[model samples]
Target: MPQDTIPNPILRGFNPDPSIVRVGDDYYIATSTFEWFPGVQIHQSRDLVNWRLLTRPLTRPSQLNMLGAPDGCGVWAPCLTHANDRFWLIYTDVKRYGRTTVGGASGASLRDFHNYLVTADAIEGPWSDPVHLNSSGFDPSLFHDDDGRKWLLNQLWDHRPGRNRFAGIVAQQYDPAAQALVGERRNIFPGTALGLTEAPHLYKRDGWYHLITAEGGTGFGHAVTMARSRTLEGPYEPHPDGPVLTARDRPHAALQRAGHADLVETPDGRTWMAYLCGRPLPNRGRCVLGRETAIQPMAWGEDGWLRTRDGSGDPELAPPSPGLQPAPWPAGLEWEDFDGLDLPIDFQWLRSPFPDELFSLVARPGWLRLFGRESIGSTFRQALVARRQQAFCYSARTVMDFAPAHFQQAAGLVCYYGASKFHYLFVSRDDEHGRHLRVMSALPDSPQADAFTAPIPLPDDGLVHLRVEVDYERLRFAFSLDGEAWTWLPEMFDASILSDEATAPGAPAFTGAFVGMACQDTSGTGLPADFDGFGYVERAYAAKVG
Candidate 1:
């Protein structure tokens, strides 16, 4: 394998549950965002190796309202398809989920789950408002049949007591003329005997309808399995060979939790799959980067089964490069100097953002001004703008001019995994401490939540520069009154706490980590913090270890 392989993980970090579609020579993929606003991240690629962030369709609050949505409970798997001279997207907004006890009762009793459809004539456009669809379950995909009929496929979630969570796979007839689902949603395929089956994608090839699903949960036992039938709604039979792709049995493999795949055919008639997989750190097997998009070269077996390049049914670390000249890679690191009025595409807020009230660009001219709303732990309004943690080893630093009149106001750099679990380094003023900078930590189930270090007095001048270095093992916080002279904090915090495993058992931490700057005035002052710049840098390392 080449040192810098191009076939694997075309997109990295927090980009999970990829649903890929190709229009002519161009390809597009959509990934889940969870509670992050500007939901349902979409990426485009011409040569398959070089992918770029295109657009997020559910930007408007009417399309997506994630306010008060718990961690990992916003947008789930999104399916993208092009048909009828337009592109169609199907997605689910999961506001609540999870089992409560042995009886299979779930927190989803509130019925906060919803599925919607949206279309656009162009890849990037003023997309149509969401058309409501049945939300019997999540991870929905739309399929266009040869007879000019449209259908929707999704997992029928069984919330009934004494039954498994995954009931079965169901299909419903969609009437394009009426722009609604017409017929009954019938049960087509229960599953492939693999429990916890979900993430269904329907495809038709050579007179057979192919149904692919992610099974064995989304954890280590995750896998992509398939079934087929002659009719759109019929008795489906599982592939005799079982799963076509998985890392569950291969614990020593570099990539883990491989599943949730979507297939696409190239102009040359070759098939490839874009799926979600994770590369865990060496010993402890903690996936700090979370699930990412990985590609595997695939082929149609003579028997109509999809097989990997090696015929071994395992994901490849360095598969043949889909036979194309390598294009220039996009810039990886993101830096915001606050020089532009518009925020970068990489930055996002916790929910439907109140742009005018929460952030300002004209206040400081060349700075981003964040007026505090709520604390970081609050699920409601929080003046936070953050970028996804795209790598395990990275450094995020920022320069801010903030003077907190009371202990309630503070602003600085943050490493946030979820609303409840984060590390904050900020400058605050108190009656006893006068003016000082501090480091605070929050962990799930910890008695000392939001623990902070003793205030380290800051310089008389209000300007402060803060930096945090995370090497996947530990996080080190540092400060500099002058840009040149830096003072390192005495205590080092564990970086693993900012991960899905460290989140509270009941909280939805399905999303990966993020880092950025934030300000909050719990004192109800609505004080504003001005930040001159924010920069993030990461080391270049291969995500796959073959």
Candidate 2:
């Protein structure tokens, strides 16, 4: 075998907790969205190298809500599988936190796990309405055995005597036709072994059932552990040397945390694994972009043991096979062409219930026109479009022309996580003057009601161009009277808080699953704002290397 040459974090930024499945030559992956709306992003890859967001499976209001902005709530880890010529997805919807109590009763903490099964004739679906699994756990995964027996795997709170406080992996027989578990659920492996195991995925290979899990917590100490059982019901034993993949032994190990891995074999019978990890910047332990997705080559030892190429017993930055060749940017999904009928898959709205009526995709033979909605701060349910955080260092620019009857109508480009954490440059009609540019950050818990810099004057002419340059650590904002002379704005934001640990407490940590870049507008009154001509480009580090 050739030396495993790993790609540089194939999916960078906020893409976390990846679950991948291969069907024919096509590969599909899904990730967790803690609070962001349009939960459980679905991505497709051809050679497992380059990826593009295909669609968001869960978009119905009945399926999700952003009220009180359910911190760390919404879609958890999702598993995608194809069996018997049908595609199935098993996922968990975290309803509410167990923190609030009524009267003298104490509430459950992160309890109430609701699992749903959605099946489709095609990978890209008109998926069936969710068949509520009604399971008592989260991070649900599905596996089908050779004999056609289906098994459902999940992580739930351990309720055994003396083990009430811990979480563990549970497995039960599943009936896809019935959309429910057939037999009694049994505890397979408790977090007690590794102290905090979750995200359990089972694979049958060479007549042995392999149960792989994430442990040591989802922080910097995160790792991937493997166990094997000769029979489905096990006296399973942990590998002699635990944690098949980890960053602890790497030279740049300080910057990585390998966890929540999904293993798959390519069309040519080559084994590969995709997992999430983060690259830490100076002074900031994690960037707001959160966890990113990476691939590595895996091989089975003579004894059927799984290991990486180096045999260093740890996952490396590069895999053995030549990485996926980059393909030309997919059409109808490029961020550069902003004048389209609908927002591209790369763009995502903030943590608000997306109202379809408030937005549209009108081709009209030319240019994308975004008709915005009411005020940004007026309601948590307003339409505020955004995309995932793609590159650590990149520039996003957009040209806009909007007419606001009142000064409250604001439209611009923003890097959004939830309502609380976002920075944007907007052009609003000034009360005394004409249009002006204002830069602001919406800190969720800040005492400062309005954390905005002084507004800068803009030309009365409707046309305005804005640019934001992110240097991984600091983001610099600049705007121009024309596209030529760019003037740097005084407002610079520290975007280190976008890490999985900092932003999402119980969420898995990895890098680069963000929806990637968005454009939006808000109104103080019941009015609409129009935007046009948005463009973005990833800054080449070599351009700044000198």
Candidate 3:
């Protein structure tokens, strides 16, 4: 507790389900990226408080393919560790999302999940391709024992009609020599009795094996629980003091749904826990930014139990910093001139590979050329490149040099939350109106799907400037032929349409909100749109106390 301040969320915006590890004085953490390319996001930190985005593993299309992935189905949980002097990563790919009667009973649904592994000689890869593992369940982690033995720990899914969807925690012996998990998979623990047990991680300390799990279904009920045993595999005893950490019962807490924790011991003999938490909108309780990564300091008691700094089982906004100095990185990018050969690290695409043929910087120097593909909301091929919306109040702008010759071709700025909900400001050529500019607010499966503004006739110069100003409550659109003179649209639509609570009753909204450029060539003739520049600015918004 020497340093003055400690930023709680080491990594911000959509970085959830953190797993941390230490190699000498350096530390590394990885998080999940569902349906987004560059499957696993890795970050490096010298001090536990300040972190930097290092690199993303699962870069190749062969390693990750989200072609037909649904809203929240792709990569699940990623567990990163340092074993055998190399960095090892284990993650799950959730393919299908539907009801199933696997084993639990009838009317029980389970996702089709698969586990895989990849390793690198150093923290920054050259990472190896994935090695297929069993699909027993999701959130697979690798635990190395003292005697050079490897084991894989994950959740066992139970589809019985009346049983818990998350059955229990299981571990199987993995042979490094054979590069496969051999021997029988043993059910070590039946969860902490809190139910919905998942995201299990094992560690050995003080001659005892410690296990951690996330329970209570990832919403306001989410939490972190712990158990320990004398042996690696046995009847583990749950912590007598209830959940080691959680915010589910504390409705007025600053950080909500704090769970899915992973611990790391620094070289200076300090312990910290990196977990997932979210800040929801006041009154509505909508988490538009998705789950983010937060850290809490820990201390060991005389009873050999690990607890938070205050032992209240709640997270802190600014915990005491460790020994190292703060070396924070930029939260997100604000502008892009399209002068570089590659997209910035902050940019990402929806459920598709980073198409070299679709988006290009070489095609038009100092500009980004995006070749149109399928329609905007298609789960398959779509021409879109976006970045996560890190804040609720922000302004996004883009200048386009595109003249759609037909109604089937359109290009413009987009606010895409998932497969079902989005808003678009586009320019297209209509049979009756020639080329026109319009705004469409879409929230499919919800009540806001039919909202569209009247089209305005556009000039034929092929140069246009579009802007979308976002506040906490609504979004306003505007356009201009000259950069200085602007014309505001007539409609002010509700911003809550791009939220987690606005989706359909049974749909999943795991990912956060995004804004960027998207185009489509529904006519089967590929058309390209050139964007001269793009800018996004996040303004300071006051937080409402719960």
Query: What lDDT does the true structure give each of the candidates?
Result: 0.82, 0.67, 0.83
RMSD of each: 3.2, 4.1, 3.0
RMSD of 1: 3.2
The lDDT of model 1 is: 0.82
lDDT of each residue in 264-333, candidate 3, tens digit only: 9877677889999887877567777778899978988889888987898988778877767656666656
Q: What is the TM-score of each candidate against the true structure?
A: 0.95, 0.86, 0.95
Model 2: how far residue 23 lies from native, Å? 1.8
Total backbone collisions for each predicted model? 0, 36, 6
Error of 3 at 343 (Å): 1.0
Candidate 1 per-residue C-alpha lDDT over 1-546 given as tens digits, one digit per residue, 9 for 90 to 100: 222456567778889999999998788999998878888899988777788888888878778887787767889999999999999999999867643444334423333568899999998878888999887988899999988999988888876656676888889999988989998889898886678888999999999999999998887888999999999897888988889899988976677889999999888889989889887766456776778899877988889888887777787777767656555556754578878888778888887645676788888888999998898767778888888887778877888988788889988999888766788998888888788999888877577767888899875556899888887757888898776777889887777777666656655656777888899999898999998888898865422111
State which candidate, 1 or 2, has the greater TM-score.
Answer: 1
TM-score of 3: 0.95
Please give, for residues 1-546, the per-residue lDDT of candidate 2 as tens digits. Answer: 322454657776677788999887788888877666677888887766667778787777666655444545667888988999998888887766434333323333435568888878886676777878765777899989999999988887643334443477888999867777899888887643556778888898999998888887666777888888998767677877778887754646633877889899886677787887777775666655577778877888888878776666565665555444544245433345555555666666545555554555562323344455544532355555556667777767766665655565677767655445567677777677667877767654356634788888776666677777777667777777677878888666756544454443333333232322233344334444444555666766422310
